[model samples]
Target: MRNLQHYTDDAFEFHKEVLKSKNTTKKDPSYKERIENMDDAIEGQFSAYNDNFVRNTLENIDSYGHTDDEKNDLLKLYSYKNSVIKNLKVKITTTAANRIINTCPNCTISEINSFDHYLPKDEFPEFVVNPQNLFPSCTICNGYKNYIWIEGGKRVFLNLYLDSLPAEQYLFVNLAITGDVITTTFYLQNNGDINNDIFEIIETHYNKLHLLERFSANINEVITSLENTIISFVGKLPLDEIKDSIIEKSNRDRIAFGHNYWKSILEIELANCVEYMNRFVTID
Candidate 1:
């Protein structure tokens, strides 16, 4: 998963603008109360988020006299197309794309198509417009991650904006050949330098996202495409030159995308396998 920079909008200012919006102020007592004490609420929200103390913050906000209708109103603020929130969403999607090829940080495959409330707005209405809590995500990852946070009392996902993704190479892929078919399987290897907490978080994130199964299912297309390219070069180039060219492409992919990227890892693995490389030589 790629790391995301939090949006730069000031939370207090954003909330103030929301309060001032005509739609928010018309016949809304909860909106009025939120406007009155937005400073405190915003501060508490940030503190809770930074400390990973969402349960406590949820409890505190539960006392804020927000009716079901009011909570729904707050949620609607995010849906308003003309709101500053829409601008912030665009900025987030653009920023993530600039950083990592428009891929979802959660899935690292699909193009980001929606903003996911990292903390569900239903549970944390006060943070509905909080830039830090919004994440640009693909529809698949966003749908799969609906309203899930803690699982069995442990945080089951990493906050891309807050958590430091371990720079060490932890993600790996193994290539296996059965008969004439090649299969790829994704895995995460333990790095001694990575703390247990971070490791557990990454592991949980992978499992919760079902990334392994997803990557494995999709890798065949890549393998087939690679084989087609190799076949085109079979009679045109010497075997050693062909191997060198493939290795060069693999290195380029690894540099363009990080070593842990599924494509890069797969390419690197294939480059090292002499048997796999030799299959191209036997073509034609």
Candidate 2:
């Protein structure tokens, strides 16, 4: 998983713009009171957020006599025609490369299709538009995560903008050969430099997202793609040369995509196996 830069927009100014735009729409009986409550919530959210703040805000919403329907209406402000939301989408989509497949830094297997409220908007309406609370994610990870990060008084997921991921390699793939077919088993290996809390967070993230199973499901495609490439090299190069070429490609992928990228790890491990090389060499 990778980290992203926090959005630089002034949070209060962003909230104000949404409110200003909403003022022009047809008003309801409780529109004025709803606007005032939203304004107060935005103002109160200027400080750092924590579990206590979330708990207090949820209680305050009830005390203010806001109905579920009223809160849902207020949540629409997050998607209102605002420059802040537009800019956030652009920044997230183009952050690390020309195109981001999945904007959720924790899982890279799928394409990004939605924004996940790091804290579910239903439960923490105050942060519905808080830039830090919005994470770009694939529909799958978003559904899997679904407001379940905090459990038993511990944060279970890694905050893409806040948590410091270990620089050393932790995710690894084990390669196994059965006759002509190859299979991969992905697992996490601890790096002693990383603290236990962060390690646990990664473990929880991997399990919650079902990353190992997801990656395994697609391993056949990866093997087929690699086999196609290796076949091209069969006659063009010697056995050792072909082996070196695959390893070089693997290293290049590792440099570009990170050590844990499925293809990178797969290629590196596949290159080292004598049976894999022999099988490729025997291909006509």
Candidate 3:
């Protein structure tokens, strides 16, 4: 999820929106569960999260001698569940730290537990509403890669908000007609400005997000196109002729031709996808 920078008022407005939806959820599936989950999430945004939070609040109230302002502050904090009715006396005054509030952009879920569908709420509950926690992934992506906890050793929750590394190199190649393919080499000789940075980002994106390397990613997607062309040629032949035609076409090694076309298409789609990648890797 991209970082969301909202004005102070927007957060309160977001809370009101949450309340209205919560009130109207009786028309949908698992309304009670949804509210409970939302209530928990809301509490996390406030002070104590889930059950641990409630116990802590009670303990705090009992242990400390309260000032008049402290009692009033707690009152406002308690009323915040209503979102719209949150008394202004509860405005956050302590830190100038930029808050990184987040919620999954894809959260249209009607079920309570399903609300944090894309977020690792069970593990990283504090980051549940953090914008960095939200990723622009497909539903299939979110479901398939659920809580990708890389096990073994000291287990830590997987971080999507990783600092990307610089690009070491980026180069492209095409098979030569009769000789070796063009050895397009982009070297990380001198220190280019952002080469390493871009590389790090791509590497992280590749490993975490499963974006393939250029050789694997770019060439593989066109295998079907190559198959289609070869099949079409063979389909026009007799049974005995089909085998020969298929062999003949494949032996010609037109996979290079397919690669050329694919590379051109990719360049058109994102002009700097290859060139900029190389530029960063190649130091002056």
lDDT of 1 by residue, 118-195 (tens): 677777776776666777778898888888877666667887766677768788888898667888878998869788
Worst 10 residues of 3 by lDDT: 108-117
Deviation in Å, model 1, residue 118 alpha carbon: 1.4
Which of the predicted structures, 1 or 3, would earn the higher TM-score when compared with the native?
Answer: 1
Model 3 Cα lDDT, one tens digit per residue, 1-284: 22222123433334434445444344555543443444544444533322222232211211122345433322222222344332221222111353322222222111111212133544444333332223333443355457753333211222222322222223233332223112221112223555543344333433443422333434433434543543464435443344444445443432322222223333222222343223223232
In model 2, the worst 10-residue window by lDDT is 56-65
- Model 1 scores worst on lDDT over the 10 consecutive residues at 54-63
lDDT on C-alpha atoms for all candidate structures: 0.70, 0.70, 0.33
Error of 3 at 88 (Å): 26
Arranged by TM-score with the best first, the candidates are 2, 1, 3
Name every residue pair that clashes in candidate 2: none
